[model samples]
Target: MSATTLTVRQQLVYEKELCERSFKDFIRLAWPHVDTAEYKHNWHVDVLAEHLQACTDGRITRLLINICPGSAKSLIVNVLFPAWLWAIRPKTRVLSASHSFDLATRDSLKTRRLITSEWFQRRWPIGLRNDQDAKTKFENDSFGAREATPLKSITGNRANFVIIDDPHSVDDAKSAAMRATAVETYLTAVPSRLNDPDRDVIICVMQRLHEGDVSGAILGRPDLDYDHLCIPLFADGVDRPPTSIGWIDPREEGENMFPARYTEKVVRGYRASLGPLQFSGQYQQAPAPDADGFFRREWFHRYEPSALPQHVNYYMTSDHAPSGNNDYNVFRIWAVDHNRALWLVDSFRKRCTMDIALGLSRDANAKTVIAPEGAFALIRKYKPRAWFPENDGTWAAIKSMVSAAMIETKTFVTIDPLPTKGSGDKVGKAVGYQAMAAMGQVHLPVGPIGDEALSEYAMFPAGKRDDQVDADSAIARALEDVIPAWLPIIAPKKKRSMFDDDDSRATSDDCWG
Candidate 1:
């Protein structure tokens, strides 16, 4: 028997083993040396049991499950997993790969010790003449050993079952490159060892890290097949009917989680440690803008009587919405003449297709049209090249475009050029976001033509669908680049000379205080 299992009080662990299909016996049978939490999830165990049975019956093999942390992942794969395998196919050769060799050996040794324990041996004893080799050729003629090595170093498995336990660590989850390394090594090196036709039934469990992590690489390639599951709260990733699934509720459905009295406990931690976004991401799982502090309301408001021209070239940008789900791209053409005055002109928007946008542009007779590159492909058959940033994708283009639209309303206040004064980085960001919140107050023209833009500009429903704002952005960007003189500048007032008091000497005989 291994040292760890001897430490466990049988009175505590074995009490309920006879009552139910004791999972403790399963743990004790597979891994007697190590102690980890164990629980039987009826749904998850059933899926695992069926899959494992298929492997032994020569029907199906090779499986993968992706799950989040804190979902009893270790107990499922680490302890009860090996015991279940041992119970099925006799002397089944198994190889397990994890992120590290030490972690691998620790898990292997624990299982090894369990199979060698008195209780486990009583159930399925290891009886072999060549005991010195540590290989107990079981009654079923199947035998397996544990070896923890780098993913690149698996020489020969000659095993039937293989389990990979999170080959990537938390740090690997962060970096796309590191995750790729772990995945590449596993695919190339580890599987070469198996000898049987049913080679190895491999199962991998890990958290969803980046989009390009090991799980992603394995999943993206058509060479391998995987049943994908994504559940943050549950231990298993198998998609179930939503009628009885999703976030867990402690009380009755719709009953208040919070009573009337404000304890100020949860609010205190929210305010103290993190910014608004950190709370949203860590607690609410909502992603926020990566760049919030750099842009400003005052920077947007460069409008002046001189800033306008008499019937030159100008445009009205609006992010319109047909429904609450997505916004419609809308914009109006304009002109500022040499006399420094403005004139609003034609408008453009469509519920469905660029056919409407093309007709609008052609009717307006605009040569240098500025629009999102995504919408560029549609109308280019008629108009000149619709200009967009040289390097940007659809999503980023949408965000910048919306910020540009808010500038046209003249709701923000600024002088000529942008102001950069007495402040460090933190103070500057605080000031910038403050200005942005203030800019939210501006209301676009409320006509039927502008109704879509106003509603979308207000909330931009569903937190996505920014194409409407993209159309508006095209207008704002064109103006900012063409007329640099239109940018606003906030100047500081001169300080008062309070030191020139009667008692305060400030003459030829200056007082050196």
Candidate 2:
């Protein structure tokens, strides 16, 4: 057993033993036949290896990794990690899942190939049980098994390690129904597949798709304790997870996450191809879409509260949804400047009772308060100087209601009915103010509220909430009369001196006469 007395094959076996101890090293040893030349290791892979090792060692139970596409997420998490785990602990069981059965099967096949390869066999002689060896599911003689199932069919299977790879496809992620189904499956079905709920580990690896994607749903829950490792295509600020596996991003802000593989030019090309919303959700891992829709962040002028000019007129605009569910009842206080530019001074949005809504409108203290068809009761209770409600077939009913309230409460509520069904569509109204925002005629206060409102505007037509946009549109329509008309100022032709050149000379004084 002396070093000098060891044979060449023995020395090679010793080296393989050392390599098998590390996940990345094992990947180098058992890389698949295709694209072996192009397989390069980055720091992210090393970090993922350490995290996976932690998972195997029972240091962390629930793990979520959100990395950009083309970052070899499946190669590392779905394929190599399972093979390496089985090599280390041959009794371990793993269940792999993806949005589609084909994808899961592909990962299972790659993992099986790695396990059955000559290098793998030489390093750790673990043979698959011939009776149970298959593409979708395979087992080793030591009772270790790896099963691949589509996310929907994940019920009735049990495993020590459950890994979900891309539970939603790009197209499916866009659909509300598909996203909900994915979330539902993960919540209701995936957890039951754990053989030992206390000691078992569940890992989810996917790029963020929608704000309601499975990743979003998990991250949104405060009760769930998961170690989140998010690696964006472009490096944002430092993301140091409070976990046993600590990772600090070395790249500066805006640098490519994997500069060696994805150059700035290549990343830019992908961004252009995917567009802002998809690129932001998929590559950037941002919940909000990039600010590039009908409303641009640059179009908004931000002002500090104290620096706000005395408004020439103030109005409150409201958009209400009575369902008291996901939709918000939004009321925005706006101030019109001497230049006729609309400035959003303050705002409030919530799911509340009619009394609270009335209180909010009364607290706004504007000359006029504009609301849509739904808030007739709020207007009658708060009785501002004027209230314009859309006359969309509910005007007659709303007017009678207001008249009854006036007789009962002895209060006058002015109802200026806005034109319904014509050129005055909701999208048309929003677009009209979008032009105003584009022209830099709209201002917003600089604060958290303003930033949130701006995000809603940026995600317009795609965002879940359009209450604020509808309210702003109502304000824009109400201000149409007061908005200054643009007059083309024509400078009179320059008076020419008598000695001026012939081409430049003009008898301006005589022409006026």
Candidate 3:
């Protein structure tokens, strides 16, 4: 068959290739300085294009994507999308919102120009749309678009698609108040501008940090739930490579994306060097694991408690993670045996009070407790055999009421192995994760482990949050001192006797037999 006689399916595949190739061209040719295809965005943008088409096919309405930054996310949301919108829903009124007016305006200009470009003109005939000084409108479709200002109020009698992209800038990402204001704008203002609820759709593309920004607000809703497309590019689910996972995981000091996401050599050398936040957000596509805290998923070994060696001088340590209607506070009891092999023996994470927490720990035969000062008075009420509170901030002050005699003086909790914030918990979480992976991912203990702790910790790092793991880390740290390394101490059997004889103690000698 001749080229002109190609089937519609063939033509579509060709068009898709064109669109994909065009994206590459747009990045390399149109805007060389702004390297677009290097990071998480290749998958993000690809999925986005597919989803928009899926919308055309009546598949889904809300398309929610959570990714880190360097991924060419904006190109899909801001630059390529408006044109895509026009293609899908001709003359569809499109309203785009970003964190700042500048970003929104710049993106609007980009889309508007692309449509009027020689490339766009090559695809769609000239007579269909009209352009007037940076603003483009398709009179045939009754659709027009311009950059939106900070919404005092959004009035849209003509908007067919409301696309909210990056509602908070990198700066605003650090501020909770700013994030909250953005959320308010989305909830209160954006809807005021919607013209067609039936045909109109809302697509939010953002990197989630604090739960305050417009994207976070939209994400918080259950009824208005949208599709969540997580494009974790760097080594799949790893932050850095040389890691257990993720090719370029920071844990491994990846030089660059060797098998890079978008294009093999799309990212050149590290320009200047990416901030930890930017690296994880943009290229890696991982949300910051711990925004404020120092610890993250990379801190422990994927250990199984049952496999942990059995030896004497084994003491259990407890520093629980809290749980409630909202947060899950975990109470973990880790033990180290005579061989100095640390095992996370039991865990207790629940939405109950101090009484229940201590009872759970004691019943599990937890011998030592190291905790945040917040648990001092409550734990003291239960009288655990030993206690240790984290030695930071006012934890020292709480000693008077906490009975320092009951608690260990030294506290060794490594939030992050390194002391810094702002980066994704790649390094800290990774080290811990490698430690856990090298050991055991989860513990399925054989006897007397708290069921709650077992369930939570076992489901951990993968359980949508990281509470149990933190407790495990504390327990692991406490094990460092308690485990016998210098000299093994064997308790002397007092007043020998017939019962102490190996031949007489049939039950105790059963394992050897």
What TM-score against the true fold does each predicted structure earn? 0.47, 0.80, 0.54
Give the local distance difference test score of model 1.
0.44
Local accuracy of candidate 2 as per-residue lDDT tens digits, 156-245: 779999999999999898777988999999988998999999999999999987778899889888467888888888787755556656
Please, what is the whole-model Cα lDDT of each candidate in the order they appear? 0.44, 0.76, 0.49
Cα-based RMSD of the predictions, in order? 14.2, 7.5, 12.3
lDDT of 1 at 316: 38
lDDT (10s digit) by residue, model 1, range 1-513: 554565456533443243124443454344323554443333444443444445555554555555434444555575456655664444666666777766666666666566566765555545422443332212223544444444545555446666677777656544546766777777776566565635456666665444445666676674665444333221222233321112222333323223222125754554366443333222222222122212222223233335444335333333334342334545444343443232323345655433233222222654333343323322232222123321224224444433343243222212111112332332232343234335542223335534554333332211223454454444434443456413333479867587656576656577655
TM-score for candidate 3, residues paired by index: 0.54
Rank by lDDT, highest first: 2, 3, 1
Name the regions of candidate 2 deviating beyond 4 angstroms: 1-8, 33-37, 238-240, 289-294, 304-311, 358-430, 458-466, 477-513
Which residue pairs show collisions in model 2?
A: none
Best by lDDT: 2
User: Going through the candidates in order, what is the number of backbone clashes in each?
Assistant: 21, 0, 52
lDDT of 3 by residue, 1-513 (tens): 555988866755555455544444333333422333333323334444666555444465666666656555677666766665554345566777776667777777677666666655555543343453444223333445444443433444447667777777767756556766777877877766667666567677777544344555665685774666655544454332121111122323333333454344454333125434444444544433222123323323344544665453323333333234555545443444444454554445556544344432222455444443324333433323334334433333433433432444233231212222332342353344336435544343554443444443433332334555555554444434333322466689777676565655447667688
Candidate 2 vs candidate 3: the lDDT winner is: 2
